[model samples]
Target: MNITLVLFLIVVGITLVITGWAARRTRTTVQFWAAGRGIKGWQNGLAIAGDYMSAASFLGIAGLIAFNGYDGFMYSVGWLVAYLTVLFLIAEPMRNTGKYTLADVLSYRMSPIPVRSAAAFSTVAVSASYMMAQMIGAGSLIKILIPSLDTTLKPWFNWTILGTKLDPSITLVGVLMMIYVIAGGMVATTWVQIVKAVMLMGGAILLSFLVLLHFGFNLGGFFNAIAGVKDSKTGLNFTQPGILYTYGKTQVWGVDKALLENVSLGMALILGTAGLPHILMRFFTVPDAKAARQSVAWAMGLIGSFYIMTTFLGFGAATLVGKSNICATVAPKCTPNSNLAAPRLAEYLGNSFFGTGGGEFLLAFIAAVAFATILAVVAGLTLAASGAFSHDFYVNVIRTHLLHGHVSEREQVLVARITAALVGLLSIWLAARVGATANAAALVAGVAFVIASAANLPAILFTLFWKRFNTWGAVASLVGGSLVTIWLVAIGPGWSAPRPGWAPNRSLRRDPVSTRGERPAPLPYIFLVSQRDLVGLIALDVACLLAAAMMLRAWRRRRTRPPLVAAIFVVVLAAVATVLVLLGVTYSLVVGPTFIVALLVIMYTARYERRVTQR
Candidate 1:
């Protein structure tokens, strides 16, 4: 009976209708996987933005900026700027080569079996990691949106199912994602993304407008308001950077742990976008390379504009809602999660407009938007994963290799649907088992971004420009890089931390030991990659790979290595060396081996990788 639930139902109903319509038309493999490659520039662009701008950005960035200020904007800046890499390097090449999945491009020249197997695994790993974070976030939004499940329907909604506690909200999220992907395929997912993107962008703009309106449309007044508010436990100054990044024990993490973390996360954003399977899959939905390029432009404009507005949204949350109200408060407080900052602000805005009823209605609307964001994003992730499973693994690898056959279009579509359902169920189970999983979910997200940057991006760059990039290097880069990323992450604080506890005390901390920034002997890359350090290096690797590709292109095509490309490598390498020196020799020795080994492997493998003369 809650207004939020009603609005949510309405959104669901509409999407399901769209899904049904899409299903009838989605008979062809091309239509199911790539929407028949017929989407318009603007349409596909919006869909790309919709798919890329996930629930994490919907409220996570706003809340971080709300509480963490300059540091939080680091995520925003990196994410928006990342499109440049996508536009410059990925979109056109992917459109030219890829058919349905990213593996299509990866396996274009190489033996399809092993290359695609690695690509498929990498895609699914990244997607699942990303999906888990969104699912965790969606679970949190349930209480606000329904406002009744935790109370009136508590008994019926909360129960154990298959050894895991089944919250109806979490189950509903999985079910909806399944419906979107299974019912309509890429066409349905595309339309769903478009709808959610419009809704999300519109809601963000409305919130910003309302916030600015309250401050007499003066940006200075709004800034002053946020700077004025204070908290006791961790008094946050929205105007400052060190509050979250350089404070307390975090300061000991490094002289500039905050800076390094930001830069690292920035790297992940830039390169990860280029490598993310779902986003690349969007390029295939357009007609050709030109459409792909234009769509990237459209997506860039839209995504860049959205990020800009997040500044207002973030500051508004700080000035209007306050951190204490958002978390670590006693009674009558909004949910103790920063992710609720935007929704809480929405509720307040509604209260200002039409009293309690208006507030409730607006709150419901925002909640619905939030869920729609989750549904759309998860659908994209599921599709990308399923494409890898059905198209790459099943069709290209399994059916073609062992059976000496190809899956029918209908069979491929059916396989994709079933895979989508399976992934959704798995995510649902994972989300259900996690009690207070916000921190862990964020950790998973970071891992995904890193894997994409370190593993997938490297493979992509090598595949496109490196003529000598053979199946051996392709397999090595995909499999080796991913394993290394996972190894680093597994050894880091996230995977090592106990599953049951999620509080600051239980999590990796500003506490005395971690602050010292020394690796416990057990954690090899603990100090080297840390969490955010890995972020910086991920970007560095991407830049380095791009630089290498450029160098190769110049040497082969222009008959010499370009000085500019050489200069880029020098500057990036020197910058990295500077970071290492700043971190002291021990940190360098512990983690520096990875780059050296990777370089040596690539060089050694290049001999076996004959250049593709025709390509």
Candidate 2:
């Protein structure tokens, strides 16, 4: 076998062995879903980091920075800051109340029917969306590493119709993820996540140090290399101040005002973090509320460090290696894809730091790590979705008839495995159809926002401080919020075609029957590419507002509850809404002041939540 293939097989084998060892102890439904509830604070924290940081972090962020400049950091900022909401509000309460999944927390006050049903729906939606993104990323990576494999293996492995080639890599990723998740469950998934997290962070840190050494460990020299490139057309240094602006720079915030844009992106980050099912399920595996709190603290540290390193990696890509090399090695065919930039940078620096042979080896190592990163994350996602399906849907809903009050441990595991396979197939199908669309990131972000705003944030906030939060309110908030978010995203700006003046067809001749035999003047294709981000933001805001209103009206009718609980609910909803609005506005405006204001708002919200809890 080729060395690369052999190396990849070895890595896969090691992961499987470790996963098998972990699965040996998972003999019960509780153990399968929650790792026997004995995981330590720090260990679970690291695993949370692993579960949260998928191919999106390793490949997406750096690629984004390479393409979007400073704006790419917005993703990192949004992702990291989102954790604060989790730390202050969601984690401890979720741990204290829930036994297995998010349904446990939301259904605490009501019938298991609505809560479990909503939990299952939201879990499947978000997990599927997130899994689709990872699958797309994995398919893209495989195409890059072994370009010829697609052609050579296509006839045997892939489906094709009418001369169009269908991608099989998506199916491969989905099947592999299913195997690991079904065989081992959360116990196996958690340990794999921890190991992958360590490898990813270590690989990043090592690459950063090697890049620095390549530049003689001089920060100034690195910037100098970047800033020295002059644009031939403008005679201005490409990397120097005002260079982009001088060339009639397109709006960095892309159609929205700065503040609205920042806030819109921030809303996705802040709320989405709390809503992530895989991350939420991890909290259940811990022993108690205190341990859950500690896990959040550790997750914050690890994630923060990793994000900072990603920023450095982006800089290294831009500085040490020229943009042309990045484009040639990663974004071939002039497609302007940023996802491949980081790996390309690694190859360039690896060759420079080590010999050509060693550099090739290092490149293979990075690829293996990226592959492992995807596998670990997909495993977690599959496990969470499967648990929601088997535990929340089947056992709670369907199999309740057959079990006569209690389902067997073996039955639950079997059902979970079957559900995992179904989910895996759905994700692979979606990824295959979507291919390399520009809206992929936005799609994933929208899912996170929908889940966080609809189910997790409201449920957690009310349960912690509100005494009157009833089953009706929880159901309305969770189900209503999720449905609205999904509807808004479906018709949002990202999916729409641009308005008329944005795109014009230049057909040369104004009149087709001209006697002079001249070409007809171009028809205006204007409005072809104009974005609807502003419209989408407004829609999302209105939907979230409607959700809050439903919850508040329900709370107001409950005369038996403490007045303070109602007051707390109002205060918490207002705080969350304000943060969401600010984030939306900042994203629209794309100004420094807007970002600063949003940050201050987040800080104040954190303080307010703490004070309310203390009272």
Among these predicted structures, which one has the highest lDDT?
1
TM-score per candidate, chains pooled: 0.81, 0.75
Stretches of candidate 1 off by over 4 Å are: 149-162, 230-236, 247-255, 327-335, 496-615
The CA lDDT of each predicted structure is 0.78, 0.70
**Model 2 residue-pair collision total:** 47
Question: For residues 223-299, could you state the per-residue lDDT of candidate 2 as single tens digits?
Answer: 67655654454565434433223334333334424555566667877887888888889999999888899999999
Q: Encode model 1's per-residue lDDT on 103-130: one tens digit a residue.
A: 8998899878878998998998899888
The per-residue C-alpha lDDT of model 1 at residue 427 equals 86
lDDT of 2: 0.70
Runs of candidate 2 exceeding 4 Å displacement? 148-156, 159-166, 223-256, 328-333, 399-404, 436-438, 496-615
Model 2 CA lDDT for position 255: 43
* Steric clash pairs (candidate 1): 264-535, 264-536
Return model 2's CA RMSD, one decimal. Answer: 11.2
